[model samples]
Target chain A: MLGAPTPVLSIGSGSAYANDRLAPAVAMADSGRVSVMGFDCLAERTMALAQIRRRQDPSAGQDERIGALVPLLRGYLSRGGKVVGNFGAANPDAAYEEFAARLRKVGLLGVRIGVIRGDDVHDLVTRLDCALPELGTTVGALGDRIVSANAYIGAAPIVDCLREDAQIVLGGRLADPSLFVGPICHELGWDLTDWDRVGHATMVGHLLECGVHSTGGNFEDPPYRLVPDPHNLGYPLADVDDGSVVVTKLPGTGGAVDELTMKTQLYYEIHDPARYLTPDVTADFTGVTIEDLGDNRVRLSGARGREWPSHLKVLVGVDQGWKAVGEMSYGGPGCADRARRAEEIVRARLDAFGSDIDDLRVDLQGVGSLFGDRLVGGEPTEVRLRLAVRTPNLEAARAAVHEVELLYFGPAGGGGATGSVVPALGVTPAYVPREQVRLETEVLET
Target chain B: MKLREMAYSRSGDKGDVSNICVFVYDQADYPTLVEQLTADVVREHFGALVQGTVVRYELPNVHGLNFVLDRALGGGVSMTLRVDPHGKAFQSLILDIDLPGGRR
Candidate 1:
């Protein structure tokens, strides 16, 4: 028999599948078994891509999938299910405007939705320029080149939406873990001082953030890989109460949801067992335990958390000078050895030409030794050599790579350097972390 | 040793969980450092600082080692604390592990 209906139910959508994604959550709400339904569409790596893409194309449109999900989210709200989604891309304000327009189109004007701003913490980029006594580094030197900055807003405003009687909550850039955090604030009416419960929810949020990852999508088990469902994988849901909660999924789903999946996801981002850092709070990933309750239900309790760090871990990319790389393929009897020999020849030639190479990075893709760091024991018949060079001089970086073909025509190893040689040089931005970032929240009039 | 990259994979729910794989990165002499810093080695090294049984697994497919420290983090680990609830202790603890490669 099912226990008490959870006041909050989270649905983690792995990716922005289309506007119609709201249908699944709608069905759950129709059953009258849940209080709030959330959809997570952001990908960890996708955020990086969005940062790079936005730099080049300032007006890039919303991702096709995210665009489609907006209206469907509006429809879910019209149907009486309190919907919340993370459709905010690099431009959350833009996404919010578009979503607001969509709500207006459906005759559901003035929906009174909430958008958690202030997480964009980009301004902190400037503060990190000068080094503080505690941090011992300059701002611009540390996180000055942050491509994108975001603060992980907590659940205060999200709970505000529930109290405001808003039907939906749309966030532009909330941390994936906060999706779960927002709901707990609505449930327990706990203040930020409730460290233990907040810690428990943070752990739950982290485990549940990746959706299926906690259910078997990325488990290390060779025999039971990625849970069960390959195509129709179900999103994870948490029925939280007090200091614990149960993780489960819709019945008959393909993926596997057991103790193993949860453990793996927990280990994914954890460093020390005592502290796990996020904008919301710092949790100890090592402090968690999983109890598999058979038939797709697992209970989580005793997960504790500590106060958030004074400074968030900022990933700022700055001008690390310039780097250019090109690739050449080689095959045949000594193909593996030949590829290495060709790279050496190019380096030799570049050095002979007075190349002031600050750093020369060579990647023998199949060889597995790209950064000259890791070396693989076995060698394949063919090898692809991706050579990169970093220097203050762009021409030198370019000239050093331009010699790839010279080796192909030179006596060292000519046959292996085949196919088109393309230039791959891009400037790397330095990364810096500031002391603190401002996190603000706003309740939107839908 | 520096904690270079920490990657994770999940299986089931909260309770009755199987294993949490943590890959530790050392300096150039990874294997030698790993041998000394194996879960058992770590458990032995931090015996006074920590408690419970910790197991180490070798991942040949990837160029790293995995540590399965059972009930060692004072509580049932994640069950006792949230992984993403922000805090300084987690990072400090990671920084506290004296490594064969070097000390933080």
Candidate 2:
């Protein structure tokens, strides 16, 4: 028999990204307010890099914090707290094994671990020659340059694993919100197909998925927007009930979780509010309402949902050769002009490589790099000229980097020159039928 | 008055697509936000920073508008050579847009 719905399901966010600081996660896990913690460890940028790391070492693509995190979460885990994370970035087996070993080391026996596979449809997309909408080409056209393709799986596997009493659940490229939705649905006894309830669950998941972003990580601006104690910002947690959720941070934590912070996060990564598409459902957040409950607590509701998308999004990684970045500072009188001259020199020098370099640009940092011509600041006493290049030709890439280091000879007062060359893994999106990705879930006791 | 004086914004990305949600600090100013901060105004302000379409969606419940800009991040992180590949700085840039009049 299914368990009755939880009157209120409390879940907290652990890590927002792959390299996110673990201190906040430690605090969130230690708090007794949440029964479940979700870690969204993979991002659009991290996924591509994870693929490269896995390619170099067969067992390297999992979340690096698994060892440290396991110990930090020991107290909560021992007390029966559950975890759901996309910890298996490019390799699920590696993540699963790490969790098993870490749990054993922490003296936590009989912990059930769930492994969700089949998100890695690298071969399936290649066979189907999936059309890469971003690249405007098919998978077969790229050939071996295509390194990896992982679909953003939904909460089904997580819910399945939880049903089997999995204490920790992990998978590769599990949609960020799904990491939380899975646990919420499982504990709340909410049906996967119930559009409205799932939407509410997704709303809660969205609120907690970004960790401090929901609290105020990127929400500060001097003289305009400010939060209390910005340094000690606490990770966000949710108090989810039937149709509504209250988003707040731990007491005494830096940052505010008021109506403004919650609203910003509500539509943070969402594109179309009316059709916010996830692997599980087409969520509609247009009518979502936010009520400030004071004391760093805000209630959110009114998120609706329709049917899920017909196809799942697959993030296909392309081995885009190497990226070279070179920078040098020009200071004192006429710094802007000198920086412009430096750019001209680099552009002219890089032209020798011709079309071998896919893309190249040079920008003056203090003057116009970020906003282009839109927001031009005053003539700075010093400006840094940054030249970046993407090229299939490794030697050309290295040559571009070397040229920047040689800038000391050309521009007057051009000191602090720095250059770097690294493999650039580009990602493009492709859609495949949901049935094509046959996701499998395995729950086993450690 | 400047939009930044009465409003705040946050930008996010999905590949080449960028979304910025702007909300008025006061609920009473929601109408002015809708009237002055149209998609066209934002597109023009962004200029070449955005190469594709700019579509705006209103969130009356939250007193905000979400603007989705296509081809906004200069081909995104890996492929683009832009400094801020994610256009994260766009949020600060958008707030510079002028409001209809001074409320002070």
Best by lDDT: 2
CAPRI class of candidate 2: high
Candidates' DockQ values?
0.08, 0.83
lDDT of 1 by residue, A141-246 (tens): 5454435554445555566667777666666456667666777666667665477777877777776676666556544334323355556556667777777778
Candidate 1 chain B superposition, TM-score: 0.47
Query: Against the true structure, candidate 1 has what lDDT?
Result: 0.53
Model 2 RMSD to the real structure?
Answer: 2.2
Q: What lDDT does each candidate get? A: 0.53, 0.91
What lDDT tens digits, residue by residue, belong to model 2 across residues B31-101? Answer: 88898899999999999999999999999989999999999987777668888988889999999987655
lDDT string for model 2 (A1-446, tens) is 98986599889999899999899888888879899999999888899889989989997999888998899898999989999999999999899999999999989999999999999999999999999877789999999999999999999999999999999998999999999889998998999999888888888888888889999889999988899999999999999998899898899799999988999999998998989888988999987888899999999889988888999999999999999999999988999898888888888998899999888888888988999899866779989989898999999999998889988988788999899998899988899999889999999888
Residue B60 displacement (Å), model 2: 0.6
